[model samples]
Target chain A: MNISLILQMAADADPERIGLVCDGERWSYRAIQRAAHGAAANIADIGCSHIALLDESSEAAPIALFGAALAGIPYVPLNYRLADTDLAALLQRIAPAYIVGDVERAKRLAPEGGHTFCSRKDFVAAAEAAADTASGEEREGEGIAAQIFTSGTTAAPKAALLRHSNLLGYILGTVEFCSATEDDAQLVCVPPYHIAGISALLSSFYALRRIVLLPAFDPDDWLQLASAERVTNAFVVPTMLARIIERIDEGVQADLSALRAIAYGGGRMPPELIDRALDLFPETNFTNAYGLTETSSTIALLGPEEHRSAHNSSDPAVRARLGSVGRPLPTVELEIRDEEGKSLPAGECGEVYVRGEQVSGEYRGKSALDAEGWFPTRDAGWLDSEGYLFLAGRADDVIVRGGENISPGEIEEVLMSHPAIAEAVAVGVPSTEWGEAVAIAIVIRPGCDRPDDTTLRTLIKDRLRSSRVPERIAVLDEMPYNEMGKLLRRQVRAHFQDN
Target chain B: MKPGTKLKSAVCDTEVMVIRGSDVEVMCGGALMSEDTPAEKSAIDTAFAEGTLIGKRYVDSDGSVELLCVKPGKGSLSIGGASLQLKEAKPLPSSD
Candidate 1:
């Protein structure tokens, strides 16, 4: 069924169970439901066919969220991390019926139309009282829930059209994979507005789990919640995992006994990091979940045991397969295809394609899926003989230095093997000779002096061919990473563009 | 590295009631290096200069936001329409 039904089921099963938590406040299932009802009433009164709201990390997030769903109004969670100009362009693109936020800033920013702005605090206060002007169920609230923009490196942003079904799939699939229970408590470090974070919060509501919202990700607060609240579930990116692991490496200790399952993946994860975590939190169940906004959240997972068994790589094949994305979930049918859209045998690298109830056929204002309805993930890699998927990187991210196609991840993977290298990213920079030249950027371990560019290039050259070695190495005080811990290779590419 | 020090702080939503003459600036998440989506090319334009946030609520790429406080030039910036000033503005207390 849909997300609305899932929430109804959970509310019916346990009305008093804690559904959400923020700061010192906790919203029980009944409380969250009433607040959702309040949101619907407010949406109706405010008169928005489609609304764009900026903040979802607040206590009012869930109410305004489900309220949009109940009101049959499509809502766009504006990406607050974007520069104001880009946001201005995006807001101009959508021209939302009404904008939602606090009053102080709106008057300063959009002084032209002060009346159109709605205070989130006011909506939240009204929702807490459960005022229902509509007063009843509106079953056909089949309107879109969100228009999330994919981070476009090569082109303009494309808004992914996510319906209630798409979001429900993410919630249910995530809940099932984690085996979430009523007693489970969620500590969300990811922003609630992003797909991964929003999905975590929605899944909590469906499972009647307690949720602690963080306005943003902070490792100290993360560890504190895990130790204090016995947080059972988390959604994080590999970089976040890397940072936490680094913290521990620096002699900081955290009691993570409460964590049960964590869903991860914005990009690739270093197997070494996973090995370390398994040792660090043996009690916590870990899953490497793979998905895109096109398919909600997770379409596949490599369970803890799978990680444990496959990690010991004696054979080159097994070692390579250790990097596998694991098997496709029951909800999805995954396939490997060549450039012609023809299916390929196992162990051959090709574009990964997914078809499922969870996968959407098109993006808003654009079509992303093929004629056959398979969402062709531009990621290139092979599915091993045992049906395990290994990702090289995005197909577009593959750098052709001279005639040889080189995956930046391959070079970075080898660079990461150096003990002193804390994080590494390789990107292709334009060259007059090679069409594109390979360049490397690195972040060294704290307190450790970085290797000179010559030594760093020699390090990669020793493991790889001279051609595979980076033409230049730039060591920064820190490797730039996002909230989810993924490396921003595109940003790195821009550095070498003019140089 | 003190464990408790806030690593980064974004100026989310702000009201400009007073502009007392400070260099109005905003620090935003320039997190595109790690993401593969092609649309992230707009980042250069995304970095908000002090002058851009005037009369505009700047939304970022990741959904975390900072309202551009107009630094009227020198003393302390204030909300243009409201009475609040940087001196009068109270920091949102830290939460667990």
Candidate 2:
């Protein structure tokens, strides 16, 4: 089934239900369906192989997404924040396309000039005005629905393909159709390019929840909108949550009692920050979702009960569950494998491998799944006795000092526990004596005195093995994170390379 | 029938998409299902009037022929005079 079936079913079930809210305008389910069909006709007439969106979050996002699916073309949401050269390279890769966003920017970045361009305003208007009849060829379930570029924190981005089957399986397996009440509204602030953003749109649509789009994220603006819209649910990255918490700390309050659930992912959540958030929003249910773009979205989730139990538990093992991303979804199979490619037992840290109907480990021109269909996530992690999965940093981020492999996440967690440290990242730097040595960068908390390197090293040495201690520490005003809140360790490693 | 083919009931508003292919004729409200819209509504068969639910999947006893109800109406899905069972929901928390 094509992804358009989702919107079609929703519209058929209740055409008059409010489906989307953006900038004071409310759109019903039938209206969005009509616009989607219109957009599909426009896309098919243009005869483009793909439809690309280069703008921030807006009404055009869902329109272009479903339109591409209905028109039997892949929807590629390009990162508008990319540099001119980088953005141009991507545009060239998906050339002979119908690009939708800023018409002027699309014209300026047209590589080889084979692509068609339309302004976001014009696209939405044309879609609304076109015929409501289905206007495209039937698309198969195996067809590529979206081509998302992975967030390249350590290396160049790869175009990951998510088939219609993969995305539909994820939605059908996780969400109950039209389960949301009429009053429920979800506030979406994540950019359109991210997997979380895409899945949020699809899942919310299927659940029949009214979607409120925030084109850009600002802490005050987010709080105000949530309060004004009575947003019942929201999804945020760790960085966004931190900023929102900071805004709350400044005594700027809105009647956020309407907010009932908040899910966070896209980055690691600091234990302290989550604890503070839990206390601050006592009535809200918290969920921690963990997945990659290739996995189609979340493969595992730490649900609300798990959050509260782990937070209030006195046992170390139970409390440690707070750091876990919870067990794999019942529909998914997860295993930890060692460097030798053998499956590791519980509590053994190794690379994560996952297999499921939703796991589409396919990139442009290549498939990353093994013969048995397991996709090696390249993420270092371990499952506890209770099946809770705790993620280390990326396998590539592991600091190899001499013959020992040290997870930078371990050392960073220790450093971040310090009262004065706001954020920390550990990386491996070249060392003649030991082949490589641990180096750390830290961002101090506001108004807190910076700790000496010796003091920090002593803290790590006390909590971990001596070899895990950093040989060098650098204090920065802030840690480098990509737009999605993923820490860029490669940039941190660069800081100590020349020293 | 082939997977992904949509069929509407000749007797009611019931609509379904084939999720598993099978050669057996499918029936809704005791009337044969077809791809075309019915010219007019027919009398609902009381014997098979249990009703179909939106978003619910119905499968044969042996689980060969599966149909997902896309539009609900007063018609239960069946194959060869036997009513299809509603597939059990797999309870999973929303993660997106």
Candidate 3:
């Protein structure tokens, strides 16, 4: 069954189950599904494509989404948080039949398409009307379901076209992994448009679980809601989790006893934060999910026990492997390869390649896969002696000193341990002598005097090889990052390159 | 001046006008007694008559219905009644 069918099933199985909760307002599954059908009927009259489009919203958004599925129209939720320009670029790439969200922004940003932008009032009314409709059986698969954008290691953001089947696999796989049942309640803090968000939603939908939605996230509210709603599961970002741990450090109580699972990915979680959360919520299971939009949501997950043991492993080799995103997820294949595309041995560090039911073949705008039918993840990491994966850094982020390769992540991880430094981002700055050298940008902790460039360089030299020593250090208030909290090293380098 | 020239507008009453081919004033302003409109603004009071969700709940752009705790301003919408409220409902950070 496709996504809409899942919603229909949930409505039938437990009509009174609270499917949506926002700001103390709650709506049952039946209420939400009926409203979506009304949205679908109205949308069908305009007739863009049989695809339902949702712009991120706080309330009444999910109903419209479900209504599209009822109409047998594939629904695509666009990420509304991006800058107007980036959003426009993604809108162009999607070129879906219709759209929803900031009507003005959507109109201005997405003008070329033969689509319509329904205003906020009209949409709310549509949902209300649809809510009165009796249960209707939704038809099977039709158009594309969702178009999620992945940041390209190359030029522009690449749009990943996801079919109903794509969503089906992600949702079902996650349910099986987590043993999700009807008893679960998911607090959805991530934006609806991201692949990760969709994955979490689909999994909850399949398990007939209730979803507590948060339009945007604040660390405090997240904790409070977990306690108040007794939310069983949640998805958080590394940055968000780091801040939550910071709160824990400040004597915040772990009121999240009801939370069963906390899944995080997007970027590497600083080891310290994970350790802190494990100690705080000893009963809560932790999952380290790893994937790009290209691979549904996550192609691999390190389970709570395995993850903790890996972190606590005495052997550096064992710990490294455990820290690595655990072995390929069920039905997924992982391989490390050299430049020639020949698969490398288990322990060698090279481009990490994945292939699975969740993996897509091509990028919407460009060819993501090489001539050999494999997409280069552009991430540089080595499979260890134990079949564990340890990511060095992005292959593009690698620092090439003449011919030697250096991982900037290593330097950043080391610098982060310094008492004065709060956050660090290391980039490969262009060089005249060597091809590229490590350049460091540090966000110092409050009350600490700015560490001089010489002092930082000396610090690196004392800890690492001379080659790994950063040539310069610039003090920044905060490292620039995308919404997912992944540092944009390319942007960081560009910001200071002229100087 | 064209509708685009004026960067902002105010709604003086509960209803405003939206030109099919022009900027339409939407439900906005959080829980305030009055809404202002620019000189170029058109009243869309007819939407209240035609709007599907509003007759029962007075949602001002946001799908909020005078809830005690949650408040929102203008909600965003997609084509064909695809809408959602814009809430400042991020979990409030507390001093731990």
Estimated TM-score per prediction?
A: 0.76, 0.95, 0.75
Chain A TM-score values, per prediction: 0.89, 0.97, 0.87
Cα shift from native, residue A292, model 2 (Å): 1.1
Docking class of 3: incorrect
Better of 2 and 3 by DockQ: 2
lDDT of 1 at A154: 66
Ranking by TM-score: 2, 1, 3
Instruction: Give one digit per residue, the lDDT tens place, for model 3 in A329-396.
Output: 65567888876888999767778887755566455445566665565777787776656667877888
Worst 10 residues of 2 chain A by lDDT: A133-142
lDDT of each: 0.63, 0.89, 0.63
Worst 10 residues of 1 chain A by lDDT: A170-179
Best by lDDT: 2
TM-score of chain B of each: 0.21, 0.93, 0.23
Best by TM-score: 2
